[model samples]
Target chain A: MVIATETFRPLVLAQAKARKLEPHLIVVKHPVGGLNAEELKERIDAAFEGLKVEMKG
Target chain B: MRIVNPTYGIAPQGEGSATAGPVDWMNDPIVLFSNNKPNAKELLLGVRDRLSSIRRVDNVDYIAKGSASQPAPPEMLNEVVRKYRIALLALGD
Candidate 1:
Protein backbone atom coordinates (compact mmCIF):
# COMPACT_ATOMS: atom_id res chain seq x y z
CA MET A 1 0.00 0.00 0.00
CA VAL A 2 1.14 3.54 -0.82
CA ILE A 3 0.70 6.27 1.79
CA ALA A 4 0.68 9.76 0.26
CA THR A 5 -0.67 13.09 1.32
CA GLU A 6 -3.68 14.55 -0.49
CA THR A 7 -1.42 17.01 -2.34
CA PHE A 8 0.74 14.21 -3.70
CA ARG A 9 -1.99 11.61 -4.16
CA PRO A 10 -2.37 12.40 -7.88
CA LEU A 11 1.35 11.97 -8.40
CA VAL A 12 1.28 8.52 -6.84
CA LEU A 13 -1.71 7.61 -8.99
CA ALA A 14 0.00 8.96 -12.09
CA GLN A 15 3.16 6.99 -11.47
CA ALA A 16 1.19 3.86 -10.67
CA LYS A 17 -0.80 4.37 -13.82
CA ALA A 18 2.40 4.41 -15.84
CA ARG A 19 3.41 1.19 -14.16
CA LYS A 20 -0.02 -0.25 -14.89
CA LEU A 21 -0.69 -0.95 -11.26
CA GLU A 22 -3.85 0.03 -9.49
CA PRO A 23 -2.26 1.19 -6.29
CA HIS A 24 -3.72 0.61 -2.88
CA LEU A 25 -3.25 4.13 -1.59
CA ILE A 26 -3.86 5.79 1.76
CA VAL A 27 -4.34 9.53 1.43
CA VAL A 28 -3.50 11.81 4.32
CA LYS A 29 -3.35 15.59 4.60
CA HIS A 30 -0.94 17.72 2.59
CA PRO A 31 2.50 19.03 3.67
CA VAL A 32 3.78 16.02 5.52
CA GLY A 33 7.17 17.65 5.93
CA GLY A 34 8.17 20.45 8.28
CA LEU A 35 5.55 19.54 10.82
CA ASN A 36 6.16 19.20 14.56
CA ALA A 37 5.55 15.83 16.22
CA GLU A 38 2.26 17.08 17.57
CA GLU A 39 1.17 18.22 14.13
CA LEU A 40 2.37 15.02 12.49
CA LYS A 41 0.39 12.90 14.92
CA GLU A 42 -2.76 13.65 12.97
CA ARG A 43 -1.27 12.31 9.77
CA ILE A 44 -0.05 9.20 11.54
CA ASP A 45 -3.49 8.64 12.98
CA ALA A 46 -5.03 9.10 9.57
CA ALA A 47 -2.55 6.69 8.03
CA PHE A 48 -3.24 4.12 10.70
CA GLU A 49 -6.96 4.44 10.13
CA GLY A 50 -6.50 4.03 6.40
CA LEU A 51 -4.36 0.95 6.90
CA LYS A 52 -6.95 -0.60 9.16
CA VAL A 53 -9.64 0.03 6.59
CA GLU A 54 -7.56 -1.57 3.87
CA MET A 55 -6.64 -4.44 6.11
CA LYS A 56 -10.30 -5.01 6.90
CA GLY A 57 -11.57 -4.91 3.36
CA MET B 1 -15.01 28.08 -28.13
CA ARG B 2 -12.31 25.72 -26.84
CA ILE B 3 -10.27 26.08 -23.69
CA VAL B 4 -7.09 24.08 -23.17
CA ASN B 5 -6.47 22.42 -19.83
CA PRO B 6 -2.97 23.30 -18.63
CA THR B 7 -2.75 20.27 -16.33
CA TYR B 8 -3.52 17.84 -19.17
CA GLY B 9 -0.83 15.83 -20.87
CA ILE B 10 -0.28 12.50 -22.59
CA ALA B 11 0.55 9.77 -20.13
CA PRO B 12 3.02 6.98 -20.66
CA GLN B 13 1.67 3.80 -22.18
CA GLY B 14 1.62 0.85 -19.83
CA GLU B 15 2.56 -2.62 -20.95
CA GLY B 16 0.63 -4.60 -18.36
CA SER B 17 -0.58 -4.53 -14.80
CA ALA B 18 1.60 -5.48 -11.86
CA THR B 19 -0.26 -6.78 -8.87
CA ALA B 20 0.85 -7.56 -5.32
CA GLY B 21 -0.58 -10.54 -3.53
CA PRO B 22 -2.80 -10.21 -0.49
CA VAL B 23 -0.80 -9.71 2.68
CA ASP B 24 -1.36 -11.51 5.94
CA TRP B 25 -0.76 -8.40 7.99
CA MET B 26 -0.34 -10.29 11.20
CA ASN B 27 2.10 -12.89 9.98
CA ASP B 28 3.62 -11.62 6.77
CA PRO B 29 6.67 -9.39 6.78
CA ILE B 30 5.90 -5.78 5.94
CA VAL B 31 8.36 -3.06 4.95
CA LEU B 32 7.73 0.52 5.90
CA PHE B 33 9.50 2.25 3.02
CA SER B 34 10.35 5.90 3.11
CA ASN B 35 11.26 8.09 0.16
CA ASN B 36 13.68 9.90 2.50
CA LYS B 37 11.60 12.99 2.76
CA PRO B 38 11.83 14.80 6.06
CA ASN B 39 9.40 13.31 8.59
CA ALA B 40 8.45 10.58 6.14
CA LYS B 41 10.20 8.05 8.31
CA GLU B 42 8.63 9.48 11.41
CA LEU B 43 5.21 9.15 9.86
CA LEU B 44 5.83 5.53 8.96
CA LEU B 45 7.36 4.85 12.35
CA GLY B 46 4.34 6.30 14.04
CA VAL B 47 2.15 4.03 11.99
CA ARG B 48 4.35 1.12 12.97
CA ASP B 49 3.93 2.02 16.62
CA ARG B 50 0.18 2.01 16.22
CA LEU B 51 0.27 -1.13 14.08
CA SER B 52 1.82 -3.05 16.95
CA SER B 53 -1.60 -3.33 18.52
CA ILE B 54 -2.88 -5.38 15.58
CA ARG B 55 0.22 -7.11 14.26
CA ARG B 56 3.68 -8.20 15.22
CA VAL B 57 6.18 -5.36 15.14
CA ASP B 58 9.14 -7.65 14.71
CA ASN B 59 8.04 -8.54 11.21
CA VAL B 60 7.70 -4.93 10.24
CA ASP B 61 10.95 -3.28 9.21
CA TYR B 62 12.03 0.13 8.03
CA ILE B 63 13.81 0.82 4.73
CA ALA B 64 14.58 4.23 3.40
CA LYS B 65 16.14 5.88 0.40
CA GLY B 66 19.59 7.31 0.84
CA SER B 67 18.41 10.70 -0.28
CA ALA B 68 15.12 12.37 -0.92
CA SER B 69 16.45 14.14 -4.03
CA GLN B 70 17.54 10.93 -5.70
CA PRO B 71 15.51 7.95 -6.87
CA ALA B 72 15.76 4.67 -5.05
CA PRO B 73 18.22 2.19 -6.51
CA PRO B 74 16.81 -0.81 -8.32
CA GLU B 75 18.74 -3.08 -5.99
CA MET B 76 17.06 -1.54 -2.97
CA LEU B 77 13.65 -2.04 -4.50
CA ASN B 78 14.55 -5.55 -5.61
CA GLU B 79 15.63 -6.35 -2.08
CA VAL B 80 12.29 -5.20 -0.73
CA VAL B 81 10.41 -7.31 -3.27
CA ARG B 82 12.51 -10.32 -2.45
CA LYS B 83 12.26 -10.04 1.31
CA TYR B 84 8.95 -8.43 2.09
CA ARG B 85 5.42 -9.72 1.68
CA ILE B 86 4.06 -6.19 1.70
CA ALA B 87 5.41 -2.64 1.51
CA LEU B 88 3.87 0.53 2.88
CA LEU B 89 5.57 3.31 0.90
CA ALA B 90 5.47 6.89 2.04
CA LEU B 91 5.64 9.49 -0.72
CA GLY B 92 5.06 13.05 0.32
CA ASP B 93 6.31 16.62 0.25
Candidate 2:
Protein backbone atom coordinates (compact mmCIF):
# COMPACT_ATOMS: atom_id res chain seq x y z
CA MET A 1 0.00 0.00 0.00
CA VAL A 2 1.09 3.56 -0.67
CA ILE A 3 0.47 6.65 1.49
CA ALA A 4 0.72 9.50 -0.97
CA THR A 5 -0.32 13.11 -0.95
CA GLU A 6 -3.38 14.05 -2.96
CA THR A 7 -1.21 15.88 -5.46
CA PHE A 8 0.68 12.69 -6.16
CA ARG A 9 -2.31 10.38 -6.21
CA PRO A 10 -2.32 10.35 -9.98
CA LEU A 11 1.34 9.45 -10.05
CA VAL A 12 0.67 6.46 -7.82
CA LEU A 13 -2.30 5.46 -9.92
CA ALA A 14 -0.29 5.75 -13.11
CA GLN A 15 2.46 3.56 -11.75
CA ALA A 16 -0.03 1.01 -10.50
CA LYS A 17 -1.71 1.01 -13.89
CA ALA A 18 1.61 0.41 -15.64
CA ARG A 19 2.37 -2.42 -13.26
CA LYS A 20 -1.14 -3.85 -13.58
CA LEU A 21 -1.54 -3.62 -9.84
CA GLU A 22 -4.72 -2.93 -7.97
CA PRO A 23 -2.96 -0.65 -5.52
CA HIS A 24 -4.06 -0.01 -1.97
CA LEU A 25 -3.63 3.72 -1.85
CA ILE A 26 -4.15 6.15 1.04
CA VAL A 27 -4.32 9.66 -0.30
CA VAL A 28 -3.45 12.41 2.16
CA LYS A 29 -3.31 16.15 1.68
CA HIS A 30 -0.42 17.73 -0.17
CA PRO A 31 2.91 18.96 1.26
CA VAL A 32 3.51 16.28 3.83
CA GLY A 33 7.21 16.74 3.49
CA GLY A 34 7.81 19.63 5.86
CA LEU A 35 4.87 19.51 8.25
CA ASN A 36 5.61 19.57 11.94
CA ALA A 37 4.38 16.72 14.13
CA GLU A 38 1.29 18.68 15.04
CA GLU A 39 0.49 19.56 11.44
CA LEU A 40 1.12 16.04 10.27
CA LYS A 41 -1.51 14.54 12.54
CA GLU A 42 -4.34 15.43 10.22
CA ARG A 43 -2.72 13.62 7.35
CA ILE A 44 -2.06 10.69 9.59
CA ASP A 45 -5.68 10.71 10.67
CA ALA A 46 -6.83 10.65 7.07
CA ALA A 47 -4.41 7.85 6.25
CA PHE A 48 -5.57 5.84 9.23
CA GLU A 49 -9.14 6.20 8.13
CA GLY A 50 -8.22 5.02 4.67
CA LEU A 51 -6.35 2.07 6.09
CA LYS A 52 -9.24 1.04 8.28
CA VAL A 53 -11.51 0.99 5.28
CA GLU A 54 -9.10 -1.20 3.39
CA MET A 55 -8.68 -3.49 6.35
CA LYS A 56 -12.43 -3.91 6.73
CA GLY A 57 -12.83 -4.63 3.03
CA MET B 1 18.98 -12.49 -31.94
CA ARG B 2 20.75 -11.60 -28.72
CA ILE B 3 19.78 -12.13 -25.12
CA VAL B 4 20.49 -9.90 -22.16
CA ASN B 5 20.43 -11.10 -18.58
CA PRO B 6 18.58 -8.43 -16.62
CA THR B 7 18.92 -10.00 -13.19
CA TYR B 8 22.37 -8.34 -12.92
CA GLY B 9 24.12 -11.63 -12.19
CA ILE B 10 21.56 -12.53 -9.54
CA ALA B 11 21.04 -16.26 -9.47
CA PRO B 12 17.81 -16.56 -11.39
CA GLN B 13 15.91 -19.55 -10.16
CA GLY B 14 12.93 -17.41 -11.09
CA GLU B 15 12.29 -13.70 -10.72
CA GLY B 16 8.96 -12.21 -9.82
CA SER B 17 7.14 -10.48 -7.02
CA ALA B 18 6.21 -12.86 -4.24
CA THR B 19 2.55 -13.51 -3.57
CA ALA B 20 1.04 -14.29 -0.19
CA GLY B 21 -2.22 -15.75 0.96
CA PRO B 22 -4.76 -13.60 2.82
CA VAL B 23 -3.29 -11.29 5.42
CA ASP B 24 -4.05 -11.15 9.12
CA TRP B 25 -3.37 -7.42 9.26
CA MET B 26 -3.73 -7.27 13.01
CA ASN B 27 -1.28 -10.04 13.78
CA ASP B 28 1.04 -10.23 10.80
CA PRO B 29 4.40 -8.52 10.71
CA ILE B 30 4.21 -5.15 9.03
CA VAL B 31 6.99 -2.84 7.89
CA LEU B 32 6.88 0.91 7.55
CA PHE B 33 8.91 1.79 4.48
CA SER B 34 10.15 5.34 4.31
CA ASN B 35 11.45 7.06 1.23
CA ASN B 36 13.46 9.30 3.65
CA LYS B 37 12.06 12.54 2.52
CA PRO B 38 11.85 15.29 5.16
CA ASN B 39 8.82 14.04 7.05
CA ALA B 40 8.38 10.63 5.56
CA LYS B 41 9.73 8.95 8.63
CA GLU B 42 7.54 10.92 11.00
CA LEU B 43 4.44 10.24 8.96
CA LEU B 44 5.07 6.53 8.82
CA LEU B 45 6.00 6.35 12.49
CA GLY B 46 2.81 8.17 13.34
CA VAL B 47 0.85 5.60 11.44
CA ARG B 48 2.68 2.85 13.29
CA ASP B 49 1.88 4.46 16.63
CA ARG B 50 -1.79 4.42 15.69
CA LEU B 51 -1.48 0.84 14.57
CA SER B 52 -0.44 0.03 18.11
CA SER B 53 -3.95 0.83 19.36
CA ILE B 54 -5.49 -2.02 17.37
CA ARG B 55 -2.53 -4.37 17.00
CA ARG B 56 0.94 -5.13 18.23
CA VAL B 57 3.40 -2.53 16.98
CA ASP B 58 6.34 -4.65 18.16
CA ASN B 59 6.05 -6.71 15.00
CA VAL B 60 6.20 -3.50 13.00
CA ASP B 61 9.57 -2.10 11.99
CA TYR B 62 10.91 0.84 10.09
CA ILE B 63 13.31 0.73 7.14
CA ALA B 64 14.37 3.68 5.07
CA LYS B 65 16.28 4.36 1.93
CA GLY B 66 19.09 6.92 2.06
CA SER B 67 17.43 9.43 -0.18
CA ALA B 68 14.16 10.49 -1.69
CA SER B 69 15.72 11.11 -5.10
CA GLN B 70 16.46 7.43 -5.68
CA PRO B 71 14.07 4.55 -5.41
CA ALA B 72 14.87 1.80 -2.95
CA PRO B 73 17.09 -0.80 -4.61
CA PRO B 74 15.57 -4.16 -5.38
CA GLU B 75 17.70 -6.03 -2.86
CA MET B 76 16.28 -4.03 0.07
CA LEU B 77 12.75 -4.39 -1.25
CA ASN B 78 13.25 -8.14 -1.62
CA GLU B 79 14.50 -8.42 1.94
CA VAL B 80 11.52 -6.49 3.26
CA VAL B 81 9.09 -8.64 1.30
CA ARG B 82 10.74 -11.76 2.61
CA LYS B 83 10.64 -10.51 6.17
CA TYR B 84 7.19 -8.99 6.44
CA ARG B 85 3.64 -9.76 5.38
CA ILE B 86 2.61 -6.13 4.89
CA ALA B 87 4.52 -2.96 3.96
CA LEU B 88 3.19 0.56 4.32
CA LEU B 89 5.17 2.80 2.00
CA ALA B 90 5.20 6.56 2.49
CA LEU B 91 5.24 8.55 -0.71
CA GLY B 92 6.35 12.18 -0.65
CA ASP B 93 5.58 14.77 -3.28
Candidate 3:
Protein backbone atom coordinates (compact mmCIF):
# COMPACT_ATOMS: atom_id res chain seq x y z
CA MET A 1 0.00 0.00 0.00
CA VAL A 2 1.56 3.28 -1.12
CA ILE A 3 0.74 6.50 0.68
CA ALA A 4 1.40 10.04 -0.57
CA THR A 5 4.45 11.86 0.76
CA GLU A 6 2.41 14.85 1.84
CA THR A 7 -0.09 12.73 3.69
CA PHE A 8 2.36 10.25 5.26
CA ARG A 9 3.22 12.25 8.36
CA PRO A 10 -0.31 13.09 9.33
CA LEU A 11 -1.43 9.59 8.60
CA VAL A 12 1.31 8.06 10.71
CA LEU A 13 0.76 10.52 13.50
CA ALA A 14 -2.93 9.90 13.38
CA GLN A 15 -2.42 6.19 13.48
CA ALA A 16 -0.08 6.50 16.41
CA LYS A 17 -2.42 8.78 18.28
CA ALA A 18 -5.37 6.54 17.69
CA ARG A 19 -3.46 3.52 18.86
CA LYS A 20 -1.65 5.48 21.56
CA LEU A 21 1.61 4.21 20.09
CA GLU A 22 4.90 6.06 20.10
CA PRO A 23 6.86 6.42 16.84
CA HIS A 24 10.40 5.29 16.25
CA LEU A 25 12.74 5.72 13.28
CA ILE A 26 14.91 2.87 12.08
CA VAL A 27 17.37 3.52 9.24
CA VAL A 28 18.50 0.46 7.31
CA LYS A 29 21.72 0.14 5.35
CA HIS A 30 22.23 -2.61 2.80
CA PRO A 31 25.35 -3.93 1.13
CA VAL A 32 25.72 -1.99 -2.13
CA GLY A 33 24.93 -3.92 -5.27
CA GLY A 34 22.34 -2.71 -7.80
CA LEU A 35 22.57 1.01 -6.92
CA ASN A 36 25.73 2.91 -6.19
CA ALA A 37 26.37 4.30 -2.74
CA GLU A 38 25.75 7.86 -3.93
CA GLU A 39 22.39 6.96 -5.42
CA LEU A 40 21.38 5.20 -2.24
CA LYS A 41 22.47 8.24 -0.26
CA GLU A 42 20.25 10.45 -2.42
CA ARG A 43 17.29 8.21 -1.86
CA ILE A 44 17.87 8.26 1.86
CA ASP A 45 18.10 12.03 1.76
CA ALA A 46 14.80 12.29 -0.04
CA ALA A 47 13.16 10.08 2.55
CA PHE A 48 14.63 12.17 5.32
CA GLU A 49 13.38 15.36 3.62
CA GLY A 50 9.85 14.05 3.68
CA LEU A 51 10.23 13.12 7.31
CA LYS A 52 11.65 16.54 8.09
CA VAL A 53 8.74 18.31 6.46
CA GLU A 54 6.32 16.19 8.44
CA MET A 55 8.09 17.10 11.64
CA LYS A 56 8.11 20.82 10.81
CA GLY A 57 4.55 20.98 9.66
CA MET B 1 19.22 -14.18 20.23
CA ARG B 2 18.56 -16.60 17.39
CA ILE B 3 18.42 -14.56 14.18
CA VAL B 4 17.15 -16.78 11.43
CA ASN B 5 16.88 -15.43 7.88
CA PRO B 6 14.31 -17.76 6.33
CA THR B 7 14.85 -16.37 2.83
CA TYR B 8 18.36 -17.79 2.96
CA GLY B 9 18.02 -20.55 5.56
CA ILE B 10 15.96 -23.54 6.62
CA ALA B 11 12.78 -23.38 8.71
CA PRO B 12 13.48 -23.81 12.38
CA GLN B 13 10.52 -25.69 13.91
CA GLY B 14 6.80 -26.16 13.60
CA GLU B 15 5.94 -26.54 17.33
CA GLY B 16 6.89 -27.94 20.72
CA SER B 17 10.18 -27.74 22.59
CA ALA B 18 12.36 -26.79 19.62
CA THR B 19 10.33 -23.64 19.07
CA ALA B 20 10.69 -22.73 22.71
CA GLY B 21 14.47 -22.96 22.66
CA PRO B 22 15.34 -19.39 21.75
CA VAL B 23 13.83 -16.20 20.45
CA ASP B 24 13.45 -15.86 16.69
CA TRP B 25 14.77 -12.47 15.66
CA MET B 26 13.09 -12.43 12.26
CA ASN B 27 9.60 -12.99 13.64
CA ASP B 28 9.80 -10.11 16.08
CA PRO B 29 7.71 -6.98 15.49
CA ILE B 30 9.99 -4.82 13.39
CA VAL B 31 10.02 -1.37 11.86
CA LEU B 32 11.61 -1.68 8.44
CA PHE B 33 13.26 1.66 7.72
CA SER B 34 14.48 2.13 4.19
CA ASN B 35 15.73 5.06 2.17
CA ASN B 36 14.02 4.04 -1.07
CA LYS B 37 10.69 2.56 -2.00
CA PRO B 38 10.61 -1.24 -1.92
CA ASN B 39 8.32 -4.05 -3.04
CA ALA B 40 6.20 -4.30 0.10
CA LYS B 41 4.22 -7.32 -0.99
CA GLU B 42 7.21 -9.44 -1.73
CA LEU B 43 9.00 -8.43 1.42
CA LEU B 44 5.98 -8.91 3.64
CA LEU B 45 5.24 -12.30 2.12
CA GLY B 46 8.76 -13.49 2.65
CA VAL B 47 8.67 -12.40 6.25
CA ARG B 48 5.27 -13.95 6.77
CA ASP B 49 6.29 -17.27 5.32
CA ARG B 50 9.27 -17.44 7.56
CA LEU B 51 7.31 -16.50 10.62
CA SER B 52 4.51 -18.93 9.85
CA SER B 53 6.90 -21.84 9.72
CA ILE B 54 7.76 -21.19 13.31
CA ARG B 55 5.13 -21.07 16.02
CA ARG B 56 7.15 -18.75 18.22
CA VAL B 57 6.34 -15.48 16.44
CA ASP B 58 2.90 -14.11 17.18
CA ASN B 59 3.14 -10.70 15.47
CA VAL B 60 5.17 -8.84 12.89
CA ASP B 61 4.84 -5.18 11.95
CA TYR B 62 6.67 -4.02 8.82
CA ILE B 63 6.98 -0.29 8.13
CA ALA B 64 8.43 0.55 4.76
CA LYS B 65 8.03 2.91 1.81
CA GLY B 66 4.80 2.42 -0.06
CA SER B 67 4.16 3.37 -3.69
CA ALA B 68 4.41 7.10 -4.35
CA SER B 69 4.66 7.49 -0.57
CA GLN B 70 7.43 9.30 1.21
CA PRO B 71 9.68 7.90 3.89
CA ALA B 72 8.58 8.05 7.52
CA PRO B 73 9.21 11.19 9.50
CA PRO B 74 11.57 11.35 12.47
CA GLU B 75 8.73 11.83 14.91
CA MET B 76 6.91 8.89 13.41
CA LEU B 77 9.99 6.79 13.84
CA ASN B 78 10.35 7.90 17.41
CA GLU B 79 6.70 7.21 18.05
CA VAL B 80 6.88 3.71 16.63
CA VAL B 81 9.80 2.82 18.83
CA ARG B 82 8.19 4.26 21.89
CA LYS B 83 4.71 2.88 21.28
CA TYR B 84 4.98 -0.51 19.63
CA ARG B 85 7.95 -1.88 21.53
CA ILE B 86 9.61 -2.56 18.18
CA ALA B 87 11.97 -5.49 18.70
CA LEU B 88 13.88 -5.67 15.43
CA LEU B 89 14.50 -3.45 12.40
CA ALA B 90 15.68 -4.57 8.97
CA LEU B 91 17.04 -2.30 6.21
CA GLY B 92 15.90 -2.96 2.69
CA ASP B 93 18.03 -3.20 -0.45
Candidate 4:
Protein backbone atom coordinates (compact mmCIF):
# COMPACT_ATOMS: atom_id res chain seq x y z
CA MET A 1 0.00 0.00 0.00
CA VAL A 2 1.13 3.55 -0.77
CA ILE A 3 0.70 6.19 1.96
CA ALA A 4 0.81 9.81 0.89
CA THR A 5 -0.63 13.15 1.94
CA GLU A 6 -4.01 14.29 0.63
CA THR A 7 -2.51 17.06 -1.49
CA PHE A 8 -0.37 14.57 -3.33
CA ARG A 9 -3.21 12.13 -3.96
CA PRO A 10 -3.66 13.23 -7.54
CA LEU A 11 -0.04 12.74 -8.45
CA VAL A 12 0.23 9.45 -6.66
CA LEU A 13 -2.98 8.14 -8.23
CA ALA A 14 -1.88 9.28 -11.65
CA GLN A 15 1.33 7.33 -11.29
CA ALA A 16 -0.54 4.30 -10.09
CA LYS A 17 -2.90 4.41 -13.07
CA ALA A 18 -0.11 4.92 -15.57
CA ARG A 19 1.54 1.77 -14.26
CA LYS A 20 -1.74 -0.18 -14.37
CA LEU A 21 -1.57 -0.92 -10.69
CA GLU A 22 -4.49 -1.22 -8.30
CA PRO A 23 -2.61 -1.44 -5.03
CA HIS A 24 -4.33 -0.08 -1.93
CA LEU A 25 -3.44 3.49 -0.99
CA ILE A 26 -3.80 5.58 2.16
CA VAL A 27 -4.13 9.35 2.07
CA VAL A 28 -2.98 11.18 5.17
CA LYS A 29 -3.78 14.78 6.07
CA HIS A 30 -2.24 17.43 3.85
CA PRO A 31 0.83 19.57 4.65
CA VAL A 32 2.63 16.77 6.33
CA GLY A 33 5.53 18.88 7.41
CA GLY A 34 6.75 20.60 10.59
CA LEU A 35 4.52 18.48 12.80
CA ASN A 36 5.95 17.30 16.09
CA ALA A 37 6.59 13.60 16.56
CA GLU A 38 3.55 13.19 18.76
CA GLU A 39 1.28 14.77 16.19
CA LEU A 40 2.77 12.75 13.36
CA LYS A 41 2.60 9.60 15.38
CA GLU A 42 -1.00 10.31 16.13
CA ARG A 43 -1.71 10.63 12.44
CA ILE A 44 0.02 7.38 11.66
CA ASP A 45 -1.68 5.69 14.55
CA ALA A 46 -5.03 6.89 13.35
CA ALA A 47 -4.39 5.27 10.01
CA PHE A 48 -2.68 2.19 11.38
CA GLU A 49 -5.78 0.03 11.49
CA GLY A 50 -6.79 0.96 7.99
CA LEU A 51 -3.30 0.29 6.80
CA LYS A 52 -3.32 -3.07 8.43
CA VAL A 53 -6.58 -3.96 6.73
CA GLU A 54 -5.19 -2.94 3.38
CA MET A 55 -2.01 -4.86 3.96
CA LYS A 56 -4.01 -7.94 4.74
CA GLY A 57 -6.31 -7.53 1.77
CA MET B 1 26.19 13.70 4.51
CA ARG B 2 27.27 14.11 0.88
CA ILE B 3 25.46 16.63 -1.30
CA VAL B 4 25.61 17.46 -4.98
CA ASN B 5 23.89 20.04 -7.16
CA PRO B 6 22.96 18.01 -10.22
CA THR B 7 21.40 19.00 -13.50
CA TYR B 8 19.19 16.04 -14.23
CA GLY B 9 15.67 14.74 -14.51
CA ILE B 10 14.66 11.26 -13.32
CA ALA B 11 11.80 10.38 -15.65
CA PRO B 12 10.98 6.71 -15.95
CA GLN B 13 11.39 4.98 -19.28
CA GLY B 14 8.40 5.07 -21.59
CA GLU B 15 5.77 2.39 -22.38
CA GLY B 16 8.19 0.17 -24.26
CA SER B 17 10.87 0.51 -21.67
CA ALA B 18 12.04 -2.59 -19.87
CA THR B 19 11.00 -1.18 -16.44
CA ALA B 20 7.52 0.24 -16.73
CA GLY B 21 4.80 -0.61 -14.21
CA PRO B 22 3.36 -0.38 -10.71
CA VAL B 23 5.10 -2.14 -7.86
CA ASP B 24 3.42 -4.24 -5.19
CA TRP B 25 4.29 -2.79 -1.78
CA MET B 26 2.76 -5.77 0.02
CA ASN B 27 5.99 -7.58 -0.45
CA ASP B 28 8.63 -4.94 0.43
CA PRO B 29 9.32 -1.36 -0.50
CA ILE B 30 12.19 1.08 -0.88
CA VAL B 31 11.53 4.64 0.30
CA LEU B 32 12.11 8.00 -1.37
CA PHE B 33 12.11 11.38 0.37
CA SER B 34 11.55 15.00 -0.52
CA ASN B 35 14.41 17.00 0.88
CA ASN B 36 12.57 20.23 0.19
CA LYS B 37 9.71 19.49 2.52
CA PRO B 38 9.76 20.66 6.11
CA ASN B 39 10.42 18.01 8.72
CA ALA B 40 10.91 15.53 5.91
CA LYS B 41 13.66 13.72 7.68
CA GLU B 42 11.60 13.26 10.80
CA LEU B 43 8.54 12.18 8.85
CA LEU B 44 10.52 9.69 6.82
CA LEU B 45 12.05 8.20 9.94
CA GLY B 46 8.69 8.07 11.67
CA VAL B 47 7.01 6.34 8.77
CA ARG B 48 9.73 3.76 8.54
CA ASP B 49 9.59 3.03 12.21
CA ARG B 50 5.82 2.82 12.18
CA LEU B 51 5.83 0.43 9.26
CA SER B 52 8.54 -1.62 10.86
CA SER B 53 6.52 -1.95 14.05
CA ILE B 54 3.48 -3.14 12.11
CA ARG B 55 5.55 -5.82 10.42
CA ARG B 56 9.03 -6.80 9.48
CA VAL B 57 10.06 -5.50 6.10
CA ASP B 58 13.02 -6.87 4.23
CA ASN B 59 15.32 -4.98 1.92
CA VAL B 60 13.82 -1.70 3.01
CA ASP B 61 15.84 1.26 1.75
CA TYR B 62 15.54 5.02 1.32
CA ILE B 63 16.67 7.86 -0.94
CA ALA B 64 16.75 11.40 0.40
CA LYS B 65 17.21 14.02 -2.34
CA GLY B 66 18.73 16.61 0.00
CA SER B 67 16.86 19.93 0.35
CA ALA B 68 14.17 19.76 -2.35
CA SER B 69 16.54 21.56 -4.71
CA GLN B 70 17.93 18.23 -5.77
CA PRO B 71 15.29 16.03 -7.30
CA ALA B 72 15.46 12.26 -6.95
CA PRO B 73 16.87 10.21 -9.76
CA PRO B 74 14.14 8.23 -11.46
CA GLU B 75 16.55 5.78 -13.03
CA MET B 76 17.90 4.83 -9.63
CA LEU B 77 14.36 4.49 -8.32
CA ASN B 78 13.47 2.38 -11.35
CA GLU B 79 16.35 0.08 -10.66
CA VAL B 80 15.27 -0.22 -7.03
CA VAL B 81 11.69 -1.06 -7.96
CA ARG B 82 12.81 -3.53 -10.60
CA LYS B 83 15.00 -5.20 -8.05
CA TYR B 84 12.76 -4.83 -4.97
CA ARG B 85 9.35 -4.87 -6.70
CA ILE B 86 8.02 -2.09 -4.49
CA ALA B 87 8.59 1.52 -3.39
CA LEU B 88 7.27 4.14 -0.97
CA LEU B 89 7.70 7.65 -2.35
CA ALA B 90 7.08 10.16 0.47
CA LEU B 91 5.67 13.36 -0.94
CA GLY B 92 5.92 16.59 1.07
CA ASP B 93 4.47 19.90 2.16
* Per-model TM values vs. the true structure: 0.89, 0.85, 0.33, 0.62
Superposed by TM-score, candidate 3 places the C-alpha of residue B87 at a distance from the truth, in angstroms, of 5.1
From the highest DockQ down, the ranking of the candidates is 1, 2, 4, 3
lDDT tens digits, residue span B1-93, model 1 = 899998897856656678776778789999999999999999999999999998899989999989898989999999999999989999969
Q: In model 3 chain B, where is the ten-residue run with the lowest total lDDT? A: B15-24
Candidate 1, residue B52: lDDT:
95
Off by over 4 Å in 4: A14-23, B1-36, B67-70
Interface RMSD of each: 0.9, 2.2, 13.2, 3.6
List DockQ, one per candidate, in order: 0.80, 0.53, 0.05, 0.33
Q: The CA-based lDDT of model 1 is what? A: 0.92
Model 2: per-residue Cα lDDT over B31-83, one tens digit each? 89999888888888888888889888899999998778998999998999899
Give per-residue CA lDDT, model 1, range A1-57, as digits (tens). 999999998899898887888999999998899999999999999999999999997
List the pairs of residues colliding in candidate 4.
B35-B68, B36-B68
**For model 3, what TM-score does chain A reach?**
0.39
Roughly what TM-score does model 2 have, to 2 decimal places?
0.85
Report the lDDT of model 1 for residue A30.
86
Q: lDDT for model 3, please.
A: 0.42
Let me know the DockQ for model 1: 0.80
What's the CA RMSD for each of the models? 3.4, 5.8, 19.3, 10.1
- Candidate 2: list runs displaced more than 4 Å: B1-20
